[model samples]
Target: MIKILICFSVIFSSGIGLNLYATHHQPVNESNALDLAANSKSAILIERDTGEVLFNKNAQEVLPPASMTKIMTLLLVMEELENGKLQLSEKVRISEKAASMGGSQIFLEPGEEMTVNDLLKGVAVASGNDASVALAERIAGSEEAFVEMMNQRAKQLHLKNTLFQNPTGLPAENHYSTAEDMALLAKELLKYDEITKYTSIYEDYLRKGQENEFWLVNTNKLVKFYEGVDGLKTGFTNEAKYCLTATAEKDGMRVIAVVMGADSTKNRNSDVSAMLDYAYSKYTTKSLFDKNQQVTSFNWLKADQQKVNVITNDSISILHKKAEDLTGIETDVKIDQDISLPIKKGTAIGKLEVKKDGKVISETDLVIEEDMDKAGTFQLMGRILRSFLNK
Candidate 1:
């Protein structure tokens, strides 16, 4: 028989052993104009560095996504690649169903063979519908099953306003996503930097050996037209009109803009570009607090130490206007009056709430930074005597 032993340690900050506990809260403000006079039915601009919404217009309304559906498909495929379930060098034979896919294709022939790397390039840079379908078939044995996986992933990501009817975001009656949902999906996709290696390519060649070399150009023009513009996806259809999900990184600031139902391709591109500019120009990242920094000191009762230092668990940063003075900001460290013994390390014992001119700006968790061993009987008695004597 094996006995399981559970040993808990109480952590303190700056060599002090005391218990602390509290709640943390913060208030955020969003004030940016990226949706200026755009006829787009829905739009959103978000700061990629922090999941903050900079501007939004009818963002939650689910509308036809068109080719934008490929974003989620690419995300799942990248996840599979990272998990070792799929490899870029692996070859997938095109099936009849994949070859039959119409609208924006790399012209894959049935029984034609291509490496997963080329297919991913086709889908990411060229927005090739045929490549998307072929990859889907290879992953799930059928397009329908792959679509189901997309829906399941959507639920897992909490994209409530999204539904996928196809692996490639072609025009489908039931397939739709809101501007807000698309932004969320884009944020999640950015976690995997591997996708950018292909999305940022402006032009490339495919099928070099087969007598008919194919030239591929990225559908998202910003990759070549704008500076610091990397990726996302572009979409268009009679019903969905012109849509674009553009991502840009500059001066350490990253932003994602989603526009849907634009009247023309030019307006869609302009709207997304303007949104990115507004976010990068108007806001900047500021480090408010750091982890394991001493926030305050607390008095202990019947303990070996009379006082303990409180600290934070993680560093916190906030996006604010450049004109704002962060040094003048006031921080209030709140903790429980009393904490029990046998406390564990890394416990959230309190919070450090920073405010600017009475308005709370950011809050971070104050945790125990070091472990505190349990006091023995004699130690406890000595602490009690000390407490009484100090009184």
Candidate 2:
């Protein structure tokens, strides 16, 4: 994660007078926002790109996550795929324990073989407990070891209100998480594009040719009915109640909404829908700068490269209330740091501060655009003599 330092200052710029340095940490005032009076026990809405919380209620209240815990399962699978430790075409032999899962499952029989791809589909679209456990065993050698990996990942992600007892989210003491924690997990899950391919499917057949073909219907109904709602998970257990972590993207903005411990499925859907609606209606995001764009150029005091261009490797997006005025926003570049000889191409030289109406909204590190070599010995001596003569 990139650490952003946000500080406010009043600055003057050409064409824009009295520019504002807007800090991204400033919370949006909720006075004029819609009254979410959501019925779910805990809920939150956040911008996917910026991780800004738009609305939340009791989001840290830990409760049974049910199958929503599978988001981490999917995340770990995606990571393994990216790292080449796992392949989609590889076959997994179902374990007797995995075949015995009781809750939502693909009904795998012991010793039956399935590809990692289909198992992913079963878990993502069908919420298959058997598939989840099978993949868990395949990834970490055993379900218990996989749970350890899951908890380790959660700790690395800084999730404070979470604990996992099983890969299928089966009801067990101490198996719980908060809405906020689940939303964060969903945010991480969305980073892998491969996930959406499976999660967005409304219905598909698992065993296409066999006589006992299993049809998989998405547990998340909103994927079929709600526009832009492609993914996430739904959970329900006698002890957990109804839970959902719904994510949607419209235009260029994406938002994640999580609802936990709702009294009914209707209430969960309604609350998650309301949160999405609030996010779309009240907030907006803009791509302020594209990745690798040269933001500015500066003189290199002692390097072989006479000049260095400050560049950004990641795109910068600003999120704000839809009603706020954006015309007066401006950016301020700060470069008080020293430049040394032999600077690397991606070395951080300074920072670009984005301001809205004179307050710092966001900031990104400015890096050296290209590699710089040290000045030759003769050139360094000549420059030293020239500097002394000039002085």
Provide the TM-score for each candidate, comma-separated: 0.71, 0.76
Off by over 4 Å in 2: 1-27, 31-34, 289-315, 327-391
Q: Pick out the ten consecutive residues of candidate 1 with the lowest summed lDDT.
A: 16-25
What is the lDDT of every predicted structure here? 0.76, 0.80
In model 1, the clashing pairs are 10-372, 11-370, 20-349, 21-349
Best by lDDT: 2
How does model 1 fare in lDDT?
A: 0.76
lDDT of 1 at 186: 91
TM-score of model 2 relative to the true fold?
A: 0.76
Q: How many residue pairs collide in each prediction?
A: 4, 12
Estimate the overall C-alpha local distance difference test score of candidate 2: 0.80
lDDT tens digits, residue span 1-391, model 2: 1222333333333222221222332224562254663678877777765566777677789899999989999999998997789999999999999999998999999999999999999999989999999999999999999999999999987899999998889899999999889988997788776688899999999889998799999989899888999999999999889999999989788889888888888778888887788778876777766767987775544667666677874456667666665554567767644455566777776777776555665667777778888778787788889889999
